[model samples]
Target: MHNYTIAELVKGLQSKQFSSVELTQHFLARIRQFNDQYNAVITVTEDQALQVAQLADQRLATGSAPALCGVPLLHKDIFCTKGVRTSCGSKMLDNFIPPYNATVVENFEQTGAVMLGKTNMDEFAMGSSNETSFYGPVKNPWATDCVPGGSSGGSAAAVAGRLAPGATATDTGGSIRQPAALCGISGLKPTYGRVSRWGMIAFASSLDQAGPMARTAEDCALLLNCMASFDDKDSTCVDREVPDYSASLNKPVKGLRIGIPKEYFSEGLHPGTEAAVKKALTDLEAQGVELVEISLPNSDLSVPAYYVIAPAEASANLSRFDGVKYGYRCENPKDLQDMYCRTRSEGFGEEVQRRILIGTYCLSAGYYDAYYGKAQQVRQLIEQDFVKAFADVDLIVGPTCPSPAFKFGAKGDDPVAMYLEDIYTIATNLAGLPGMSVPCGMVEGKPVGLQIIGNYFDEARMLNLAHQFQQVTDWHTQAPEGIL
Candidate 1:
């Protein structure tokens, strides 16, 4: 039951091969057995999950149940869950539990999906590695010593470890794709406004977008179908109609143009990663897909521009967490000023604080025009670059990260090296386009992800290509040793 994909689970439930309660129990038991090993789950709502499963079973008994009825999934901690700890992996909000469900959580509930628990994340969705998580870093299932990619790492790790079939995750900049690559799972970052952000905790509001993470593209597509919906509550949510993402999974692949950016294959990419991406491209080519060399001229400036823009937004968004509000207030402050200073400094992790400082500095009156304004201009240029490349290509393909999962603390001393880890993925967020990562190959036993970048609202096409590739290769099905 734990190993079954969401699609298979759906069928099994429909056929009454197992009740939702039974399936939920199997996953609950697995979480109990393996969570300590991976630190993937931060909370276990066994009692709540079982109770929900009973309701799902009742709905399943009816002929007209929701699409994901009886499916159990995890949520990244960044999303608010009513009556459950919605810590966002930071001590600041460790004691905070929301009274309302995030739109993503509400959507899953509407599908009759049982919530397993919340997964850890980098505090406030900052950091390229999960090391900044206040709950402690989520270890990569592939190699316990290796770091899973950041912010969304726990979601990716939980899915990869088979603790859940699928989970919700967000990407401010490559948080979903990078971890999915390192943890050997399929994760999607939908077009910025495709999903509602009403109850999701903000990081870089303009760049943050939530999507699904699972072992297969088929599962991801199914999850995405439930995850995306326009909500008026969120000002950033798009009003466009949400399509059935799984409907196009088997779409024909012949003659589809895939762009290979020269910058993605340039210096600093690990040799193993480049080889794996090339082989994946070749496999697609063999299936009649056309590979075209393209140039994203302004892509080179994406990292610098993103750092400036994201932090600037983050600074403004996180200001609400000051001691005057509900989260983590300092005790016995000499005054309100002392309280605000101590609360944030003590509540946020080092990485979160560092970004906040950088953001505050950039947004300061004297520096705003020089740093924030200039970065916004560069961001526009980067978006234009993608617009130009997509003119002749259906999608763009590249390595999700410069390398596979690195050993914990490998780049802790040098933040620039850590920041560059997301060099390949930040552009998608900057452009507010959809992107996904699917397991393509392995490097030194760690998985490599092949990133697919699609035009806005073109997620179905991206999933179709990913599904086609998976059908020809077993990479997406591969699990970490001892996981099963």
Candidate 2:
């Protein structure tokens, strides 16, 4: 049951091979067995999960239930869950419980998917590795000593470890894809505004887009069908028709043109990762897909531009947590000013503070034009580069991370190196395009991911391409040993 993909699980539940309660219990037991090793989960709502599973079983008995009627999944702690502590992996909101569900959570609920728990993440979704998490870093399932990439590391680790078939994750920069690459799973980031951001804790509001992490592209497609919906509560959400993402998984990809950017293969990429991505491309070519070499010259400037723009947005979004209005407050404050200073100083983790300060500095009156305004101009160039490339190519392919998962603390002291970990992924976010990471091959026994970037609102097409590639390769099917 734990090993079954969401698609397979749905079939089993409908066939009466197992009850929803039985499936939910299997995952709950797995969480208890292995969660201590990775610290992947923050809170387990076992009682609520079982109750939902029981209701799903009742619905299943009637022979008329949703496709994901009983699937169990983990929600990244960044999402607000009604009655459940919605800690955004920060001490500030550690005790904060929302009275309502995030739109993503509500969508899953409507599909009758049981929420097993909330997964750990980088505090305020501000780090490239999960180490910045207030709950502690999430260890890679493949190699316990290595770090799982973040801020979606917990969700990636959970799916890769088979603790859950799928989990909700957000990608602000490379949060979803990098971790999925490191942990050997499939993760996707929908086009900005394609999914509602309402009730999701903001990191870099403009760059943050929630998607799914799962063991297979088909499972991700199934999850996306439920996750992507426009909501009135979120002004940024696009009021477009939500398509059936799973409907195109079996589409033919014989003549699809895939672009490989010259910039992605330049300096700072690891040799092993490059070899793996090349091999994946060769395999795709053999399957009748056409590979075209392209140039995204502005890609080199993505990291610098992202650092400026993301933090600027984060600085404004996080100001709402200044020791008042329902979060952690400092004790024995000297006065209002002292309370504000002390509460923030203590509540936020170091990484979160670092970003806030950088953000504040960039948005400051004197520096706004020189820093924030300039970065936005660079961001426009990055988006234009993608727009030009997509004119001749259906998709863009590259390595998800510069290298495989690194050991914990290897680059923790160097923030620039940490930021570069997202070098290949940040541009997609800057352009507001949909992207996905699928397991390509292994590097020194750790997995590498092949990133697929598509045009705006082309999530279904990207998922189709990933599904076709996955059908011929067994990389996405492999799992870390000893977990079971």
Candidate 3:
């Protein structure tokens, strides 16, 4: 029961294999048993979940079921849920109970899906490890001493730990893919504008995107279909047609042209991770897919460019949390200025402050053109690299992160090392393309991920390829030992 995927669970529900309440209880039981060890969940709405599950069962009895009706899923704390605490993993919003649901949350509710509760994340969606979460760091279920990557670490940990079949996560500078890679689960960051940002907390508005994290590519496709759509509230959302994402899962890769970027395989990548990616590519090749060497010369600058642009956008988006508006406010301020300073100082975590400082410096006068503007130009160049590479290939592949999950606190003090955790994934966000991480192999008994990147709005094909790879391998289905 615990090992069933989303699709399988949906089938079971439809066939009356188990009641929705019973299914919800199974996961809640698991969470009660193991979540304290991983700290993946911040809240558990068992009563609300059972109430919703009962309604879903009634809806199914009436033959008014949506594709994912009665299924249970978790929401990242970044998304606002009516009457539930939407913390964004910060003390600032720790007490915030939104009066309304986020567009994604609303959509899920419309489908009759049960909400398990909110999962923890980095403060203001900052940091590469879960340590920055105000609730506490998430332990990697595979190795208790290692870190679960962030800012969506809780989402990744929950799905990987089988606490939930899938969870919603947002990525701005690799928040989704990096953590999914480190945790050895499947995660997708849809193309910018592909998913609406109506209620998701902003962090680099131009780059932030919400998507799905699950154990398999096909499962991600189902969740992505429910999550992606145009919302009038988000002006940047593309008003394009939404497809039935699950329809493409069985597509063949007989003539698919795969790109092997030289820069991605060059230096900074762990040999074991590289070897695992290579083996996965070999498996694809055996399935009649063609591989071609492609070049992305400007890829190396992705990190520096992302740091400047993302922080600049983050600084702007985060400016709304003044003491007067909403969120944390200081006690008995001397004046308005003191109120602002105290609120921010006490609200934001260390990594968030670090980025704020970096953003403030780059966007400051005399440094704007030298830093921010230059970074924008490099961003365009990086996009051009993808354009040139895609012209000759159908998709690109690489190791999601440079290495597998690392020990907790190993890179906490070294900000640069932590920033480099997204080196391979940041380029996709910079280019505003869709990318996914699928379980490939394990290193030192920890799982590694193989990343598949696709052109803008080409998520269907990327997911198809991922589904094919998963069909032949069982890595995604494997779970941590001595649990469940």
Model 3 over residues 135-217: C-alpha lDDT tens digits? 99999888989988999999999998999999999999888998898888999999999998998999998889999999999
Q: Score residue 112 of candidate 1 by CA lDDT.
A: 96
lDDT of each: 0.93, 0.94, 0.92
TM-score of 3: 0.99
TM-scores of all candidate predictions against the true structure = 0.99, 0.99, 0.99
Q: What tens digits encode model 1's per-residue C-alpha lDDT throughout 1-484?
A: 8778999999999889999999999999999998998899998899999999999999999878988999999999999999999999999999998999999999999989999999988888898789998899899999999998987999999999999999999999999999999999999999999999989999999999999999999999999999999899999899999899889999999999999999999999999999999999999999899999999998779999999999889989998999775779888999889989999999988888888889999999999999999999999899999999999999999999999999999999998899999999999999999999999999999999999999999999999999999999999888889876
**In what order do the candidates fall by lDDT, top score first?**
2, 1, 3
Range of the 10 consecutive residues with the lowest summed lDDT in candidate 3: 317-326
Q: Model 1: residues >4 Å from true position, as ranges?
A: none
RMSD to the hidden true structure, all candidates: 0.7, 0.7, 0.9
Model 2 residue 227 lDDT score: 91
Among residues 3 or more apart in sequence or in different chains, the pairs in candidate 2 whose N, CA or C atoms overlap within 3 Å are: none
